[model samples]
Target chain A: MSRLAAKFEELAQSGRKALIPFITAGDPSPGFTVPMMHAMVKAGVDVIELGVPFSDPMADGPVIQRASERALAHKMSLRRTLEIAAEFRKTDQTTPVVLMGYLNPIEAMTYEGFANAAQRADIDGVLTVDLPPEEGQECSALLKARGIDPIFLLAPNSSVDRVKKMDAVGSGYLYYVSLKGVTGAGHLDVADVENKLQQIRANTQLPVAIGFGVKDAETANTIAHLGDGVVIGSALISKIETNLDNPEQAKNEIVELLTSIRQALDCGLGTEGVQE
Target chain B: MTEKYNMPDERGHFGPYGGIFVAETLIPPIQELNAAYQKYLKDPEFIAELDADLKYYVGRPSPLYHAERWSRELGGAQIYLKREDLNHTGSHKINNTVGQALLAKRMGKTRIIAETGAGQHGVATATVAARLGLECVVYMGAVDVARQSLNVYRMKLLGAKVVAVESGSKTLKDALNEALRDWVTNVDNTFYIIGTVAGPHPYPAMVRDFQAIIGREAKQQCLEATGRLPDALVACVGGGSNAIGLFYPFIEDESVKMYGVEAAGDGVATGRHSAPLCAGRPGVLHGNRTYLMADDDGEIIETHSISAGLDYPGVGPEHAWLKDTGRATYVNITDTEALEGFYALTHMEGIIPALESSHAMAYALKLAPTMGKDETLIINLSGRGDKDMQTMAKREGIEL
Candidate 1:
């Protein structure tokens, strides 16, 4: 199993939900990205989703888009993003960093090159927002051969048959988009998500992580109680964008926010077990 | 002047304005389109099908009518209208949509996806999808959803799933974003029916090629009627599809000057303009390297226009190339000027034009007064004003 999958399985068996914090790499600057990733890991994040900035991020909300824009402005190409991961790997290797972005950058780097780069960078997995499983067989095979998991998203609109097809191809974990619209638009219909989760659980034994509009601790806790993992992206990016000039403070604030949600998921005693 | 047209290179770069700069995931599909287009261009079967569709379905060879009343009122140059509005679906957008839909069928794609601003293209795409028995999905901005509910319903009625995109300013750009996302995800089985002569690679060239029929027909009609081409040819430039279509055949005709009027929503000086050719610089937007309005920081700013169709912050790359090469001149027409021209055309000639087309009309009005009486001008009436009637009525304080 991939490190991400193994981690999720461990958490699932222990009756603990995975806390996944997403941050756009090189947002504000690359200088702070590694530190931010480390801080999230320290703050009780189980899986870290490192977003690779793209010029047109259609699936993202304004907050994440602005964060991506900031990163791209600093010339955050896919090569630079991989370099950041390589740097991050020098000090830490067990965090299971998954590079999440659109397919253009990966395609720009040929499948073999990208798989090799991911292996060198110590990337645990990849989840392209736009590349569906049916078309991703080659990429999946290459990444799998290199021991990098290839994750896929399952939307509410995605049929059960389609989810099963993705389940056959996907590794690490399945990302369930909580809403039909783009990130951060609608209120989370928790009931709808619960129903979809039930449907997904019936077809695949893969660990499912719910993202899109999981803003506050309450919603995070609610999603954690149901799914194996909870992914927070737009809300975290919004905070980072709001405090861009002082990234340290933004980092602290995000760590604190995730800590609170982690505590909530653990019923208020999660901080006592921090290794650091 | 060259009698035969030269094909643009594989990159779709029409002199530096157009090129495929899309994501890696879309490259294979773009290449497929390029190959398909090259083959289809030479195939008599494809041409016959498209020709028949244009003639019967889109009501092609639309009449070039002399606007005698408007010309007499202007009292300078003779004015004529290339009536593209008379085509089915009430706009020039159907011309490209139908052609692309046919191409999509030839490519063995099962689904069609498109993005729309004013919902005109969405309706056009959905109409073609319905006709061709393909599943269609259209992405429209949530803001546009509110503004163009009728078109939204029209698209749905024609058997398309309309997705309201609420991200990134919740406008046309956002709709384009969602559509791009969809295309990336479904590129294997889906054909992205780009509404304009924009985007990466084959799209700009393909859309322009389809739309170029306008200029080809107008040129023949104008010469037959007046014994010479018009002194000036005018059309509005959003992504420059309609304008390029109307301007392409006349590029080599030095005496027949071509004008692409952009929407100066407030004014170019105020930075609230859509005049990308006149004011924008080279930048990457929507997967294509093109001329776009960008701040000193290279950030794309929001553009404003009374006409949603002309509200984009970028022009088609070909227009930027044409401007640089001196084959075409780009001009800006302000909202007030376009509005005034809208009323003038309606009152004088009893023809209501889309606000986008009014930009060209406004420019024609400005140029008519200085021209000799014998000089004639042709304007591409790209679309009917029915879509804008509600907004126009509200702006004019009409009860309806």
Candidate 2:
């Protein structure tokens, strides 16, 4: 099994909701990225999502867009992002790192190049926001051949028919965007998400992760109760932006938020020995 | 003459401006377009469809009307207007959209996607999609959704799905972002119907070729009416499709001077301008290397213009090439000046032109007074201003 699948299975067996923290690589600089990954893992994050910055990020909101801009200002490319992952793997090998970004950069590098680079860098999975499963056959096949799970996003606007289509190609955890617009624009419609999750669960046996607007602890806890995993992006990027001038403080703040969410999910799961 | 039509010199320069400065993924596609266009230009079927559509649907042979009153008011030259505003969908934008949609059908693509600002291009794409029975998706900025709600409704009514993008600055540039994302995802079965001459290689060339009908007809009409071609050809330069179309056929005619008018919201010196050719430097934007108003760090600066259609910071690569080669001159017209021309044309000639075309009218107003009485000038009236009526009324403090 892939690292992402194993992590999901372990969380399922423990009856614990997985906590995923998203960070854009090279936001502060390449020098600070590996340490930041270590910090998130130490704070009890079950999965780490590293964002590969693209010149045009359409699905991201203002906070993440700002973070991407900062990264791009440093001339962050896919090669540099993978190098950061490779550096992190030297110290820590167990944490599952999934590269989440738009498809342009990956497409800019051919599918074979991306698959080989991800494998060599110890990257476990990829979730391209714009690459739907129906159109990702070549990339998915390439990644699957190399044991890297290709994750897909299912949204409220996606129909049951579309969910079945995604199920055929989607592996590892399926990301469920709670809203229709870009990330961080609106409040989470919990009922709408729950209904969509239930519909998606009926179609696919893959683990479902809810994202897009789970900002505070309350929303994260609520979403964790209904879904297999919770993905946090804009709020984490906002924290990093607040403490950007001081890297240590920024890492501390991000870890604090992840720790609190991890503890809350553990409490809901009734897991006795899970570390927060 | 044949050399004039050929493109991309040894160094990828289109008269010293255009070049392929794109991601490696797009290299194959750009090369494919170059090869396809070369062959397609000679194909009888391709020429037939394009000609038939231009004649029947686009209402080609748009008249060259003598604006006698406005010309007399200028007190010098006899000015004429090429009436592209009379085309279907109320703008010259339809000409390129129809051609690209037909190409998409020929390429065996079943889905089409486009990006829009004031929704002129969206309406044009939706119209062609409905005609061709292709599924259409339009990406528009959230701010534009509120401003151009009627056009959005029109697009939906024509059976196209409109996705409002609330990212970046929430403008035309952001709409372009979403459309790029959609194109990358569905590239296999989808054809991106780029509306302007600003994207990667063949798009700039293809859109210009489709719009070239404007200059071809205008040149004939001007010669028939005045026994000689106009001394000057003026047109607005937002992405430069209409301007290039009206200027290409006349490029070899040294007697006819060409002027491209860009939008100057306040003034070019104030940094609140869309004068890409007048003030911008060479840069890559929207997949094509062109002249763009970029900052010290090469980041695209936000442009200001009263006309949403003219608010982009980058001009088409072909226009940049034309400007560099000294084949065409570019100038800036302020919002106030364009507004004056807008009202002047509406009352004087009974033609309410698009705010974009009004920029050209404003330039003509300035140039006509300086020319001799024997001199004739032609200005491209690119589109009707009905879509901008509400904005104009609001700006004039008139309530709906």
Candidate 3:
């Protein structure tokens, strides 16, 4: 089984929700990404979603967009991001690292080339922000052939028919965008998310990870109870953006944030002993 | 040849060029738009309403005039100008905006949003929004909002809120990003009217169908005026709406040659031009698989053009398909050549063409002299030059 499937199975047996912390690769600089990945794992993150910076991030809000701009300024490319994942794998091998970004760079590298490079780099999965299941068949096939899980997003507006289509082709987990807006925008109404999750659960057995507008431990912990995993992105990147001149402080801040969320998930859910 | 040029086979692939390469959150909205478009496109009532608005509101059947003086000076082919510049609002952009705004209304949308580069499309969109009394917002790059203040004010005067996007290489592409964000956020009540023949499925094809009226009218006019189809067709391409608008009706007419003029800022060899089909490679950007000006590592490069409308780093997917199929030829026109065409027409025909359209005019000037005078070349004069006066003045070292 892939690292993602194994980790989810472990989390389920332990009665604990997974904590997935997202940070853009090479956000402050190329050297900081690997260290940040390690820090996330130490803070009890079950999975890491590393953002592959692009010049234009249409689906992101101001916070993550700034993260991408900073990464791109540091000359971050898909190949360099893969190298970062390879570096992160030097000491940590069990955590699944999912590279997420728009499709242009992958198209530039070609699907087969990207899949080969990603596999060689120890990357576990890929969630291309712009490529839905309809447009992702060939790329998904290539990634699956290479033992890389193809992740997809499920939005609040996704109809039952669309969810069924994604459930058929999608692997790893279904990233449920918990709100109606882009990342980092909109107020998360837990009730609205719960309602949507109920609809989504009726259709597929794939693990559903809820993300978008997850700013605090309270929201994250509340969301943890409602889904298989809680994915926090813009909130963590905002910490990096605030401490760009101090990489050590940025890493510490993210670690502290994720650790607190991990605590909240454990305490709030009254689950088994914390991973740490 | 088959009488039909059927393409974008159900999956939105224009021979592997156009597809829905947008984020997952966007699929449902795009699918809704596609369904609505499929429904209303074949409905006779919708067609009649659209045709009536095209004629009565937009003042269609814009004349195809033989530029007698300009042709004599060019000294070769008798060149005819399809006066899209004379269309209401002084450009062909209104054709697509009006069509989309009407569709938005039919879809029960109360608000309309759009993105603009040179501000032509924003103004066109704002005009229709005011006509329909729908709330409108337009996203423009901060750099463009500054360069084209007059258009910014024009949009405001038309009661549309204008948002200045200050992002990476703040220009057309950034504005496009902002518009897409707005659409994803407000997908329920808002309808995004993309200004180009790019974006995911339904957009490239839908915008092409709406703007195709230009070629449809020009084809009939050319036959009526010259007693046969013109031997050649030329139009300037940015995101390639105007060019495709004029070329789509003629794609099946093998006797008519098509030329798409791209802005070669200095030259294609200079690596500064916006001629994606001529110089760049295929990549996905702004929701479609098309030719783009991206660097080796896949970073989108900033494009240079004297015309803000043609400064985009990508072209429409149909143009890419057309180029690959050898159905149409693509060429480039430098800023220097376009300026000469701009001045030549102003002096000879008393008609000033937009800098975007001047690229087509420039290519026509070079090709007209090489062809027989009996042959006819119809150029789609896409817009008027009033918006370019400041750029022209600055180019001549004068403060406007």
- Cα error, candidate 2, residue B224 (Å): 1.1
Candidate 1's docking class is incorrect
CAPRI tier of model 2: incorrect
Q: Which 10 residues in a row give candidate 1 chain B its minimum summed lDDT?
A: B1-10
CA lDDT scores, all candidates in order: 0.84, 0.83, 0.92
B1-400: candidate 1 lDDT, tens digit per residue: 3444453566566664566554334555776788998899889999999999999999999899999988888888999999998999988999999899989999999999999988889999999999999999999988788877878899999999999986655777778888877776566799999999888778888898999999999999999999998899989999888998998888778778888999998999998888878888786677665788765434466788888888787778888877887778899999999998899899998999988898989998898887888998999999898888878878879977
Taking the tens digit of each residue's C-alpha lDDT, what string does model 1 give over A184-273? 655888899899899999999888998887998999999877788899988888778888778878988899899898888877335333
Pairs that collide in candidate 1 are: A104-B24, B17-B317, B20-B201
TM-score versus the correct structure, for each prediction: 0.69, 0.67, 0.99
Model 2, chain B only, scores a TM-score of 0.96
Report the lDDT tens digits of candidate 3 across residue range A1-276: 999988888888888899998888999888888888887888899999999999988999999889988988889999999999998898997899999998989988989999999999988889999998878899999999988999999998889988899899988899999887889986888998999999889999888899999998999999978999899999999888889788899889889999899999999867485656
Model 3, B147-175: lDDT tens digits are 87888999999999999999988899999
Which has the greatest lDDT? Answer: 3
Question: Which portions of model 1 show Cα errors greater than 4 Å?
Answer: A1-22, A25-55, A59-276, B1-7
- Going through the candidates in the order shown, the clash numbers are 3, 0, 0
Report per-candidate TM-score of chain A alone. 0.96, 0.97, 0.98
Clashes in predicted model 1:
3
Q: Candidate 1 overall Cα lDDT vs. reference?
A: 0.84
Predicted candidate 2 versus true structure: per-residue lDDT over B279-394, tens digit per residue = 98875566656788765435567788888788887888888877877878999999999998899899998999999999999998899999998999999999889888888888
lDDT of 2: 0.83
